[model samples]
Target chain A: MKGIAKKIQASEVETLRLRLTEAEEALQAIAKGSVDALVVGGPRGPVVSTLAGAQEPYRLVVERMHEGALTLGEDRRILYSNRHFAHLLGYPVAHLVGKPVANFVAPEDAARLADLLDHGAKQPASRELKFRRRDGSATPALVGVGSLTLDQTPALLLIITDLTAQKHSEELAAAERFARSILEQATEAVVVCNADGRITKASFAAERLLDKPLEGKLLADAVPMEVELPAEAHHSGVRMSSREVLELVLERHSLRGAEAQICLPRLHEKHFLLSAGPLSDEPGGCIGCIFTLTEITDRKRAETQQTMLVAELNHRVKNILAIVQSVAWQTLSANHSPSEFKRAFDGRLRALSLAHDILTQGRWGHVDFEQLVERSLAPYHGGDHGMRAQWSGSRLSLPPNMVVPLSMVLHELSTNAAKYGAFSVEHGRVNIAWRSDGVNVLFTWTETNGPPVKGEIKAGFGSKLISRVVSYDLLGTADLDFDREGFRCALTFPVPKLRTDALRPLSAAPSPVH
Target chain B: MKKNAEDLSGYNLRLYIAGQTPKSIAALSNLRGLCEKYLSGRYRLDVVDVMADPALAQRDEIIAIPTLVRCVPEPIKRIIGDLGNSDRVLTRLGIDVSAKV
Candidate 1:
């Protein structure tokens, strides 16, 4: 009533002015999409007029837009916010009116929206901001701001788009790029083919392996390899086209790896572990094929070497047995007593074992001379009745064949000194030394500080064996002297460029070391 | 239309809306603002969503939304269009109040 009294007391001119203001306000409200339903004359009676429903097409479009759309007055107050905009913030549409748009923006991203507003940005030009929902959770959004006039008042219109799905696909695209980089730089020969076995893509390694670009060529025609599956294994070892072999691999869900030998131009036959898999476009739908060829040349060579090594091991075992028999036969005849014969046979056996140990350490290749001498006399050192042996020489690389024979000779000399020459006394010592002489090594075993000298050098089985091996096995000569000081033996032997297989006759050796 | 100016204090009003659409919700919020300003402590208001109860729409003789009906003070009156314009709304409702401000 107070408000009514204030209006009723107004002069006639003021009343007219108030009416015009109301009419303008009403026009502005309609322009701002706030139309009210009115009652009008109908055929039956008064009926309600849905003034808003008249804008059916445009309202329908704005109502159903995927992106949130809203209009802001010049003062940054939201004059018209669509249902989509209100729903994005999880708020009632009525509450959004006259609210500043920045109220819904996260504090940090509030400036991002300001940039668009200040720069007068238009469609397709946008700034990214985080929009805070009614629940306080943030949504990353792209905001495009444009100028428009609503009810003759300057306004800004915004279209906000969500960025969740775009971010997810960007991550997916990065992963695909990572996979592509690996394929481009792959080392194994990788080939891609269509369903009809036509080549589509090949890695740089595949191009290098074939010595030509692999596009537009049939995979079988590009790689003309002989199918080298084991003769007794897989199928019959009949000649097969590379196409048929690859299909046999891809057609099955399992059974992929095979052995193939490619004989290329100006190169030895290359061995590879051939593997194939299906390129699938969908579940259980084969779009094409992919093949990887891993070169196994070194492995194949080592396999051949291992077979040869086993054969060599067999020959050496037989030779050792024969030498053992001969030593037992000779030792039994030379010793007067059974105890002496047993002792001599054991010593000779121990000598062979020490030398064999050194050869085995060298993988049956080059044996060191200093290591062999020290090892042969190792048993006679540091005991109550021990013979001190010192070696002083430039180290020599002894061929594998001469190691056993030379070590045996040193064993015999040391045993003789322990019995009569130098090691018979507690303070007696011996020196075994050598020096490299051009192609030959000059080696010596000298004993001192012993009650010595039989005028004659003993012609026992030890001397006889030593001379025989130095001449026959080593292709060298040995000289022994029974001096008053002690006993001395000097030997000279040629050191050949040696290998493990050179000790005996065998098939051609492979070149892959070890 | 009978004014019955002596018994116009307590206003009984019903607003018909289709849904929570922007236009319908704005009509509702604006109408609430108007009633609180002019008929404070003296009005009975009912907000009906026709989508929720179509039978109520038929009972109220509502053809379109949002419809504001003044049922009290006899000779019922209907006024619609932007209730955001409180002066225009009051003028249509036969209440002589200040509309300029």
Candidate 2:
């Protein structure tokens, strides 16, 4: 019986030792986190419970999180991914695991992620990168990376946030800033007023023109002008104060834009063309009134000047027509037949027209004396006249008043020379020249190689025009010497100081001709 | 089919949900609480996520989320919403449940 007890005691000792070894192995497994569950005795019975890692409760928490959570193995292969992370890439959670993390990273950001993983994850690092989706599209994301241990193996933990909505808002804000800057730089004065007619915003131009900061001031006080509404507004008896007009524009929801002219007497008698429109929000609801003021003072002045000039031109044209009518009547009375009247009237009209052409070419300012002489003699030469006229004079300019009468005198002398004097024959020649003696100009005309002159020529209209017109209209004296050999004339005119003072200096020495 | 005694003594209920939405989670917890209080040891509950098994939702004729169907109650009854009010849920499911302690 003692021997049987000793054998039983040995068997019990071995069994206890084996049980203790198994318990130690279980404790080590628990410490290492490799066991999924544990069983312990409770008051009622034995309880079986799972470790937190093996439970689905934490998985639910991760799945419901807004940010994407993922784990990557040391080789950068996805070890685990929550639903949000998979959804960010447009993929199923099951399809994401075991894939290379670089496959979901944009090509440009893959290198950065690879380098980060190569460093084996120390402190948490975050980067803004584009993440490629399963559909071959990309989305901007902010990814935070850190090192973690999964099943005793080093891995990377990533938290991803979608930047699509955030980036969109940022871009919208930037566009708004750009538009505001453009408005600030606009040349037109821009003012924004609220429903109360108080200025909410004013551009730099508006502030400068108003000579005060216009923001927060009443629109009427800022502009201080009498507004002229459209004619239709007048007929409708919608005469409105400046403030009331602004309010009316805002209230007229269907009317988008309106314009009026404002006269600001206190501000340098300035005229501003004010254009008002409702500033609309994104939903197309009117928020406030936007008024733009464009200064029309200079334009108004130019318009007034144009009106006065037109009226003055009308008066002058009527006077000129009367003078032409008198000239036609007088020339007709002097001539006997229709052909004679036509010839004489046409010649005189051409002379007047030639003078007007010179004045017009000079912008109706002053006619150059040399230019007048060359033009008046041009038609008389280079035909049967054979370039027989010679002219020499100091450079001079004539006032508009002197151009017409002087051209007429020159015209009558040339016609007479062609009909009876120097130009009547092939070898006949005429010499016309002038010189200024500081205050008066002495002009002389000589005809040579022409028919002999009568002893005393009758004072016909041509001679009367030459002798009377040049002296009376030019404020000068004239003489005619019809010698038996040729005809000669001399005239002296007081050179107006204004004309001499306004003369442009001669560009070069005059070529000698006589 | 003739009703068996065992089948009549128990309730078979199915809850249709979509993912881990807050409403679906609340409905699930509320249903669990109601089952424990009113039909403990006499009810069988199955939670189906429509996002995971959409075909089940079509088969069950579920139009809206967080719907509970009592399948084995002879006349099938469907309840919608988060089931936050326990009394309302119990009444809607035709079960007499006392308030929880």
Candidate 3:
């Protein structure tokens, strides 16, 4: 009211003098003496008459209506909304005047509205709040509720602005940042590729395994260049269209060579076992391949060594078992009592043990066959100047698996010849010769000058173990002959299984280094 | 001490409280301890003091003691009492406050 009085006081007589009559009528009702005078000044008598002619039905343009003219009346129902107030909450002026404003607010926000209303009644000021919309959604808005009058009737006004979009974007940005952080820290290597099989993105491990910047290389071309593949490999159509992929892997890995071990390749002075599998697009296309490379060189070497050691141990156990059988059979054949058989059997076992110690000392690859024979027969042939054992043929380093069985077989036969065949008399001599027959290995044990041997129809455990080893483990052929003069046995197996390298000439005389 | 929590760019805070009580009072009191710690500079604290401000506490959606709000850092972050949980508060504050808890 003071502001209106100030405006009226400051108005020039020319601007207010004509409207003075109507202004006086309106002010008389609200602030009876507030307007001392009224005036209207603009244009001349003809424009004034034209204005007067239009006045009775013309719309009164209410200027400076800075009051809470919108009303929620005694019934708490909205009864009127002026153009300015209706536009404040995005309502059409005619549509909002008779509707309850509470219907437009969200139900959940109504409690907040009640709280704000209580606050507003005590301390009226502009505040931030959410407004209910006609569409049943609520919007964050700034509402200013104050006490005012509309043509002398009391009312309330609310002004609002929608803040949903701004708040939603901030939330979305925060979620995006969190997702990006998890992606960057993922444990599995992640690679993104385009439909052409070119790499679009790669993780840190890919850079190290590929040994090159592969941000844009075709995957099919990239695989072969990275590893050596085998020549004979044919793809079995397991995964890829090209069978050449298997050959490429074999060639790259160096698996064909005798010395080669299928394992990881060296990288930065370390080694990594690498594998690659294709990544396909969700909607039908080959995007690229994901490569996994793990450091496995130490593990591979250890496994190979362990396998070899186990195989060698198994072979040795079978051989010792055969030697024990021979001792028992020979003692039984000589008609010995249990105590004598045990004593004699123990001596033979010790001889076999000594031979084993020598071979093991040499890491079990090969033992001097001649030195082995001399050591085994020496106990029985002691002080007999005429007895002799001879070895003839090439000396080759036999693989450990072959050496144990062959040594035990020879040991058993020599013990037999000493007890009942050629070496029973002082004039005995034994000749053992070995030679390679292409892929077959042949070794002969020939004895001469013992008590004249007669055919014995008995089959012993010693012979059985020898046959078992030759047929099953060694995958070979064996023959034993009992002749009138002596006994001879010949054994044969695949050459490659016995010898590790080409055979070399043997020293005619037994090497004393045994 | 004024550590990484004060240096955080945005509001990222978590308040771990047993329930609504007033040892939460000392916590809030000590958080005012950080008034000189962070807000002495340019920070806004929507003190979810968890007592008189319990409804605002629900808005900040906190379950712990004397929590502090890092309003200026963005998205509005809350840190519970037991000021010892400073590092986690700082890291969370470093991230936008409106992110997943």
TM-score of each: 0.51, 0.52, 0.33
Clashing pairs for model 1 are A36-B81, A36-B82, A37-B80, A37-B81
In candidate 1 chain A, what residue range of length 10 has the lowest lDDT sum?
Answer: A505-514
User: In model 1, where do residues sit more than 4 Å from their true spots?
Assistant: A1-69, A73-125, A129-141, A146-149, A152-155, A160-176, A192-200, A215-220, A223-268, A273-292, A303-311, A314-322, A346-514, B1-79, B86-101
The DockQ figures for the candidates are: 0.18, 0.02, 0.01
Per-candidate chain B TM: 0.83, 0.84, 0.48
TM-score of 3: 0.33
Clash pairs, candidate 2, are: none
Question: Candidate 2: which stretches are off by over 4 Å?
Answer: A1-172, A184-187, A195-272, A280-287, A295-320, A381-387, A426-429, A433-450, A466-514, B1-101
Regions more than 4 Å wrong, model 3:
A1-91, A124-132, A142-154, A190-400, A403-514, B1-101
Which has the higher DockQ value, candidate number 1 or candidate number 2?
1
- 1 or 3, which is superior by DockQ? 1
- Candidate 1: tens digits of C-alpha lDDT, residues A79-170: 67778888888986656665678989999987877777876634335788888998988888888888887658677888888876787688
* TM-score ranking of the models: 2, 1, 3
lDDT by residue (A378-490, candidate 2, tens digit) is 87776755788889998776777677777887888888887888888888888989989988988888999998787677666777766666666677887877777888889
Instruction: Please state the error at residue B7 of candidate 2 in Å.
Output: 15
